[model samples]
Target: MNARTPRLEEVASLAGVSTATVSRFLNNPAMVAQQTAQRVQAAIVETGYLPNLNAGALASNRSRLIAALVPDIAQSIFNDTMEAMIEQLSADGNSVVMSLTGPDNRRLEAQIDAALSRRVDAIILTGIVSDLETRKRLKSQSATVIETWGLPEDPIDVAVGFSHAAVGREMARFLHGRGYRRPHLVVPRSGRSQARASSFAEHWMADGGEQPSILEVNIPSHFGQGRLAFRGLTDLEHRPDVVVCGSDWIAQGLLVEAQAAGVRVPDQLAVTGFGNLRLAGDMRPTITSVDIDGARIASEVHRILRARAAGEVLPSSLVDVGFRIIARESA
Candidate 1:
């Protein structure tokens, strides 16, 4: 309790243990003897020492702290992926933490900066960071920088994501092959949607299909937007026979809207979505779209970190978890 004493060091001294031993006890409790750990804990409580964990991590050269940063937690796709990764990674040995960066902001860069300041063991970032300074800082820190959700041209370290371009190209080919001449696109103005929407438009035009109408909406909230787009699309001079969405929830809303108007799916207005979430198949007619396997994404990210920690050289910068075109009654 001395005013001049260092926090964790004071507690360690009070427990008759070296600072390194106390650090190990905090990072890996299994390495410390029960009696010694009890003594350290008692000393910590008596001295009111919370331990400068960041300083301890810097001195040890390993934090054993893994952080996953998401652009927005409100998005279900990321919610599922992060949930799976956290549960699985925590089960193995690492201490996993989360940072919810507001959707489509530079918050990811700031969070990554903070993580590097503490020298976290691993950092999994969802979505792309476009800043050059940020990339340089990331490379300098050289922490296990993993880009998830959105694939980057040059990953800071490793990447795990489905190709939005491929998904778009495939959707165009699928609906066009089925003789749906008019397939309009609905996507959010953020994240992967921009890529998906732009690629879909490009590929659809290149495939000799008409320059289909495009509508942008707030993503991860696509269901309600889909409902609104449904009426908008149907009222067009030449109504779209098919609708491709940035997410399954969006497509589901379109289907629900069509049904209420007694419009038969596929027969009248076809619907398709991306992400192929768990509930996609449980819908009345089962949503048909590109399936991005969330579980697989989680596992790959885990392996990347574990492999690096094992001192194994990873041969690839980006690992593609390919998507499948799941055809259902919708399209």
Candidate 2:
């Protein structure tokens, strides 16, 4: 006298169709005849059968899943791009699974393995894969791979981002043009910031400028670290006339510390940061920053993914979103 759970067979029996026909209706209603699909839908409603998506995926060879691996979700620098990508993917009926692997290549590889095990259709990775083993494993996999932040000359698959090297050179040029010599660089200990810092140093030297003092803080650039970096720069024999921070959070911190120390901005010291974060404009003596359009990066990512999904060959695998140096009161 107990009610039993309904099965696909029961739904198929009620719909007066074979199990294959019912499955076609459930997985892709458009593939089935309209009248037949309606009959299967009515049977599904009557029998209260829940289609197992895993089973459906096995049959159709699609999980409808996309995995996105970011370094840190707490950083607002990546939030805009993440949010925009998620919104667009959701609208297209794809589920995004986000995993934070920090900047550790081993951890990122593990996450990639897990995503591949789950049979994800695509993967969005932040920055280039520097680890050879990880890159090899990724290349061996069949999933569609996309590396963001900036398109590399040779990408794993497809890449969408601005050039960190270009950004660094631009920062150096911008400060040099403003008559700010004796520049100092503050960056996180690891990750793409290193590339920016290196490029900045190279450009500074090429311009016949003396070697700038580069301060490497702990991983994950933050306001507190910015303060520490500023203090460290102050300890140098000859203090820098201008400080270029890797991100706005750090630049803003430097500004706050400068104000507290009675140091006048732009007059006594100049400051600039990358990312052009939202708070950049909100800060007093608004921050000078290099702006990369996160929304546009996300849009391009979506477009490339859509094209790949449709089995269309892309003319180019790399897309350069470019960067902008916004001159503000601070520099």
Best by lDDT: 2
Which parts of model 1 are misplaced by more than 4 Å? 1-59
State the lDDT at 272 in candidate 2: 91
Q: Give the per-residue lDDT of model 2 (tens digit) for 143-249.
A: 89999996677788889997888888888888888898899889876667888999999998899888998888776778887788777875898899999898899
**Candidate 1 lDDT over residue span 1-331, tens digit each:** 7576557778888999999888777765656898998898788789877766567567767677898887676646777888889987775557788987776664776787678776688889887667788777787775788888767889887889877877778888877798889888887877578788788889889989878888888644657887898988856778888888878888888889989999998898889888787667988788897877888899999888778867799999998887789998888
Candidate 2 accuracy as TM-score: 0.86
| Per-prediction TM-score to the true structure, in the order listed | 0.81, 0.86
Q: What is the C-alpha RMSD of each candidate to the true structure, in Å?
A: 4.9, 4.3
Backbone clashes for every candidate come to 0, 1
Model 1 TM-score, all chains together = 0.81
- Checking candidate 2 for backbone clashes, the offending pairs are 150-161
lDDT, candidate 1, at 144: 89
